[model samples]
Target: MDVLIVGGGLVGASLAIALERLDLRVGLLEATPPGALPAVFDERNLSFAEATVNALTALGVMQKLRAPTGAIARIHISRRGDFGRGLLEASRYGRDEFGRVVVARDFGEALEARLADATRLVRHRPMRFLGFAESGDDVRAVRVADADGERVLHARLVVAADGTRSAVRDALGIGVEEHDYEQTLFVTRVRGSRPPDGTAYERLTDHGPTALLPRGDRHYGLIHAVARDQADAVASLDEAAFLARAQETFGWRAGRFLSCGPRSTHPAIRVVARQAIAPRAVLVGNAAQTIHPIGAQGFNLGLRDALTLAELIADARTIDAGADCGSDTLLQRYAARRREDRERTIGFSDGLARLTANDAPLLRPLRSLGLFAVDRVASAQSFLVGGAMGYRGDVPALCREVRA
Candidate 1:
């Protein structure tokens, strides 16, 4: 096989699909069953940037979703006590919408359906990455355990899409640079009396970041961030109590929140791997870097990494039929190409996680002023909106390859 990808989550599955378009012999080993979805795709909401939508469209992954998808016509960002709110409208850029929102379960269903169609791709379910050793100077021998027992497979390259606590990364001795925000995020689906208006919200308060994302069924998705010490108390509240507290913190911008779905909590942290490329292995998705979810850039960045590597491999293959896809030269180029986006995105997310969570009295006015500037200044609005829409420096061709 030309490539063996470990971990068949969103990034890994998408990578497999992208590489298949290049006619590469690809093998995907997923620890779960053939059709079983990973835990990462729980009933949470995912905001896709325009760039992400383009890439997924090119990969033919966007058309398979069956659940309701909502468009974000505008994003309203404000501070709790601020008078001015920053609003980014799609009309400003001549775009129909800034992006789309879909439940992760719908996305997972689409991915599982796509995995059923394989022309030059092989998918192994209930299989895992045990470790690796030198098969030869040209390739690495990968060990995996399955129902039939452990076996070895040889491939020129292994892509780690195994998530933040990647077993593959751990096996490779790749160190991770991690940051704990000392906060926890509570995510729930909420309903308001008002109808859905295609607007997403991000409100910064003394508590933390509160996001009200629109869902297709006129329900608003809520992501409330609170200090870790207060998470348990918040999570244990009754539905009525929760809604009351949400209303108190979030205000009446979206109307009164009447009901909410089951709540889930996750600790906020930024995890960046010390190295993304090894001798014969490369890391993508959470395996590479796990950024704060503030800007919704995690999956977008991971998808870009996959597409860029796929494009590079295709270019190299055209010149030499037996090109070393995992050669040091190719890996070095991948690392270099990813440097600017990776650094800027990581720093962007890290900065947001810190700045917004700060409760300093002196900093409040400055932060509020920043929001006012983003609202009033066209250039400032463009810069912030550009990043939110995933138009960072040096956008790759694949992100611009959407057919529609």
Candidate 2:
């Protein structure tokens, strides 16, 4: 195997597809069998930046997705304190949309279909990775066990896409810096009287940042961040009571909230691994970093990780042909390429979360003024668009416009 990917979630599956596109032999080990996914789309709806959408489109997965679902053409961000509001419209940037929003399940299923069609990819289901040993010159042998028993699979590279609490990352003796915000994110889908009008809203309140992302059929994906202690009360509230509270916090931006689907909660934490790569091993997706959902950077950042690593691997193959490609030097180069973008994104998300989570009087005015200034400043708007598009530095070829 050229690359052994652990975990068959969205990130891992996408990584396999990306590598196979380069004509590389790839093997994926998944604890879950193929064609199995959660029944309904998770309450979460990921905001796909233009770069992410383009990358997925290039991979041929986007074509499988249902069309006319959820597209965010505008974004309205405001801090509830004294911070004034800032509105960003796609028209200003000469584009039709800032990004698109898709239900988690839909995106996963589409990627799974594409993976099924890739001839260079192999999948092992219901398998557990035991460990690995450095075998030949530049070959790492991995031990995996399934219902049939155990065996060793050797590969030039191993990618850990297992997720935030990554077992492979721990086996490599990598340490992560973790900050628990001590908050719980309550997520649900709400049907309202008025349509979203292609606008997403982020309201930073004293409790936490509440985001209402536009969804199909006059529904919105609602997320309210609150302290852990207060989560039970909010979750236990009746429909009317919950709607009232949501109305109070979010106002009538999408008109009155009529009903809500099942509610779910997740603890908020910001995690960054000290290192993303080791000799013969590279961590991608949540295994490398996990950020608070304040700006919807969690999955988008992971997608960027997958695409960046794919680009590196493709470049190495072009240069070395049949030679061993996954060396320490290759891993180092990949790390260097990713370091700045990772640091900048983590800092931006953490700073935003902390700043909005508080209600300090002095800080309120400053935030408001900053928002006002950004609205009037073209440079600032461009910076925001660049960041949102996942082009922090040395933009990847696939992220740029497809040339003739």
Identify the runs in model 1 with alpha carbons over 4 angstroms from their true place: none
TM-scores for the candidates? 0.97, 0.95
Question: What lDDT would each prediction earn against the true structure?
Answer: 0.86, 0.82
Deviation in Å, model 1, residue 322 alpha carbon: 2.1
Residue-by-residue lDDT tens digits, candidate 1, 169-203? 99889999999887888888999989679999998
lDDT of 2 at 287: 92
Residue 385's lDDT within candidate 2 is 74
Off by over 4 Å in 2: 38-41, 134-137
lDDT, residue 129, model 2: 84
Candidate 2, position 103, lDDT: 77
- Please give the clash total of every predicted structure, in order: 0, 1
lDDT per residue (tens digit) for residues 1-404 in model 2:
88999988878888888888876778999888656863323657788888888888888888878634577888888876564787888889888887787878778778778887899888888789888765876778988899899999998988998888888898889999999988898888888888778898988887778899987657898998878889889888988898788888888778989998878888898878999998788998889998989878777778888888888888887987774557888888888988888888889899988888877877887788878866777887777777776677655567675512
